[model samples]
Target: MGQLSRPIPLLLLFGVLVLAGCGALGPGFFADRSPRERVLLLDTPFYAQEDYQCGPAALAMLLAWNDEALSLPALSDQVYSPSLEGSLQPAMVAAARRHGYLVYPLDQPAALFAELAAGHPVLVLQNLGFSRLPRWHYAVVIGHDLARNRIFLHSGRQQAMEISARLFERTWARGGHWGVVVLPPDRLPATAGETPFLAAAAGLEQAGQWSAALLAYQAALERWPGSFGARVGLGNARYALADYELAQRAFRQALLLQPANGAVLNNLALALAAAGQRQEALVVIRQALELDGIWRQELLRTRQKIIADQP
Candidate 1:
């Protein structure tokens, strides 16, 4: 038979390709899809899956992608960042109860990255991985281009960039050390008034409407400056807006009133990290973790980032 006419070997090759990642198919001919879809790609799009994904529009898929042993730290910039204190696992557990998937977090970002390297899927908070990128960062990895050595993720900026998988692995491994809050699938606030503001803040942040959330928190503060809730809201909103100085001030003010408050401290550290004071951020984050026993697990992650940032 002519080599050109051979079909047996080619058929076997196709079968192997089909078996990749449990039948996972690369974009192949669809590699050049629009950036919008690319950024929002998920295991099941808007359905359920055991893959990472953005919110609401990607909830079901996120749930299916949920990793029970997996967790994520609060986005210091995410409005819900405040609610992440005191028991990250339970915190995430509660959140997942309502959102369909728990935002898992590790004690340290580095550990999480190592887990990812070993083939574990996790929800990583910004500052944890890709530290030098920007403040207020958030994203999820729905897929990866292993052969091409690329990592696929849905970024908070709503743009999908095909970053080098090797770059991500190296960067994530080296960096996921700042700090992390393990989130369980169920993290519900036990206090009143905490729910509303955090919900609003998360929504605003998800929509990239930081200005409005910041102002709303300010108005709440005017009526109740001592309200730790309001202050936390302000701090997170400011961080989301990239108002690093202002975020620091907000977190500081909240700390002054609620000294040893985990939310304010970790958030303050987050602000410091954004302001280019990573060491300070580590110190503050440690203080926050110590103040809340639930945060003990986060120490490693926070410490890792600090170490990586050092010259």
Candidate 2:
């Protein structure tokens, strides 16, 4: 945990928000849902690099769990935090580069928690994120346990440390349904150019600089409108800023290029809900849930929550 300098403002804000009694991340107060209920899981190490099929594969698993399967999101700009240890612990900036994922470069663990607040997952190269693994391993985030506050985590250890979502919440604030990292063989390029735009987006996003990321993505889109990467990242950036209308527009644009993509739909629905279109959001998310399949636990939760909130 270096200088939480980047997330100072967000750390301050998140602390106040949580302390002010804004409910923790989870199902609604109205719902009778209990932590006893199951959540989805994605098995990726906290800080993996080029060989990190687990993280990307876990993302694919989440979509599959939702009954909505598609190629992995461009993943070019999405960010992650990692736990590192020993001589194997290369810097996050360098590691993220090697993996072609954006690294926020904040050493402070508090900053890591802030990124969690924003909906991206963290990756550990060495053995960070977890205080101690029963058997040494990495984990991917799939869901959270608000009541317990742990990350509902899992990994590839001999027995695996499947535990409460709150357990991982020590440095991770927002999380849900984590465990069971279903994976395929090696996928994704081991490394690529850290696009200037990607770097700018990660820096802006990490510092709670949503407006800037949104603007940068918008600018990037101007140069490459059909860029799935730019559009998807723009949608997320807008959602973080609470500009749901624009966020939905961006996600919808991405979907146009890759129709029936559940991840895009899931996020698009979120943006719609934030913009005060709950009913429509529910409709869209339900469609994604259907695509993910009736057995998708994560989408099921999201669908049930939206339906429960329906007027």
Candidate 3:
């Protein structure tokens, strides 16, 4: 990790300068909230950072609050860069995934507040200095006092740092307002939309966490019952877990929502074939092939499998 006493690099300074010239990060969604609005604070554990270890420390706090309780040093191994003297963003996402948590970026500034309201701590990047000399830092936002126009964070050596919302936004904007939350398989982010949340759960399915991915997809479907992507994910997870009947049901439901979706039709065919309905599977696979685009090869493969397996 980089030394705390080191001066900000020229490149970072230039980035900060550019952000400064762009003006405020737009009138964020929460700007109109009354000063007397409700305050929210999550009971998250605090871990003071040891120099450039804020990334690990902030991640540990978030994990602990989520009941993971991983050690900071252990996380450092996953996210820290010995060469760059800090953690990279992809490594941070990977580390969260390794721990069986689905991580999604909070794109809107207001989403951070929404997550806090839902009792989830958010790890955010900040530039804590002037445009001429930026000090990059990672901190966990655990609470907000709209009445005071302040945000509470576990930052640096301080356990509970109260910063003005304006300053916080300025620094956060420099980092592209980057924030992320690690969610358990069964829980969906309070502020997360259908597309991003489905994407996150799909990542779990891709990693072969069939059961976890199933739960994530179930949550997504609960939030968005008509989401074709969620249904496809549910079907894929069920298929991976060998629940062919449910897999067929999920794929069929997705087809009902998007009748011409070739991928869904292909998955339905595979589920039918797996469940010993070879003739029916061939019919479905043919339909998939009829509507196929990028999934044409996959539909053809499913059709071949059904034909090969016919008694």
Candidate 4:
């Protein structure tokens, strides 16, 4: 509990919780035993937590690594909840997005090591207490030493806190294995799949970050050229930026991947219409109309809009 500074009463409770929480390790640590003697120690920056500000402090570490100039206090104001005395996960994600970073969720414990190996610091949530009696804390995973069976973290009040990998898994599992790797939109997470990577980029789109979303989608396409979602998202991001011709190009490429896909068809038609290819837009929407799916209403709307558009 070196980094986990709490009230005296809570400190005493945490000591008992720690004793009670110790038990057998899960299969997760043993699942991927390869790369047996590897080690990666990132030069990640550290900012010690002030009370319940581990969330912001952890985020600051990641942003600093990315060379973003935001200070710790400013970050605290953005993510901290006065009533909750700490920050929520969603807020942490949103704050990262606001700073133009792609916040990718690391769903598995194995992903933490994978990302660290790839030189990305991972922000993780830990349950420092028992599940029923929870004391939530956030920290950054900067490196791993497999030979010594240790994982390094920038935790509360500790710049280089090391914990056993087995114990780390238990605490992380109790915290729902929640972690994220925050990086610029142009960089991809080491273990991110096509689906989740596209999903994270879509979040930037949803946030109205068209330029950032464009970069993210482009990065996704670079890694996964066959990803229909990346192609569609690239188109959507372009459309938002009023680059109708470029958007149409992306939609057309996406169509090649999955011809007769209603969503892609609708998007392509919309882009065509916006680019003033009204006749071609009408034809595309008509083809989409023949596909039997829930997008029928949406297709008809695009058709109607194209028909009513002035030549």
| Best prediction by lDDT | 4
Q: Which candidate should be chosen as best, given TM-score against the real structure?
A: 4
lDDT for 250 (candidate 2): 80
What range of 10 consecutive residues in model 1 has the weakest lDDT sum? 1-10
Error of 4 at 140 (Å): 0.3
Cα lDDT tens digits, model 1, 1-311, are 11111001111211221100001123331233212222223432222212222322222224444443323333212223334221232222344434332122343323433434433344433333444652322345544543464656555434345776444544444433222222221232112133343443343333445565565566556655576666766777777667789878877887777787554565677677767787787877677676866445444455565556656
Ranking by TM-score: 4, 3, 2, 1
Global local distance difference test of model 3: 0.73
lDDT of 2 by residue, 1-311 (tens): 11101111212211221101003322342133333333333432232223334444334333343344344434312423344221121222323333322333232233333333433343432233444431222344434545444444334321124454323433332212111211111111112122434443444455455665566566666665567766777777877766677778888888888777666777777676666687887788778876755325555555665566555
Please write out the lDDT profile of model 3 over residues 254-297, one tens digit for every residue: 77878887767877777777777878878887777777676687
The digit string of per-residue lDDT tens for model 4 on 153-187 reads 89999987888889888888887888898989998
Model 1 root mean square deviation, Cα atoms: 24.2
| Candidate 2 displacement at residue 86 in angstroms | 14
Q: How close is every model to the real structure, measured as TM-score? A: 0.36, 0.37, 0.82, 0.85
Which ten contiguous residues of candidate 3 have the minimum total lDDT? 1-10
The candidate with the higher lDDT, 3 or 4, is 4
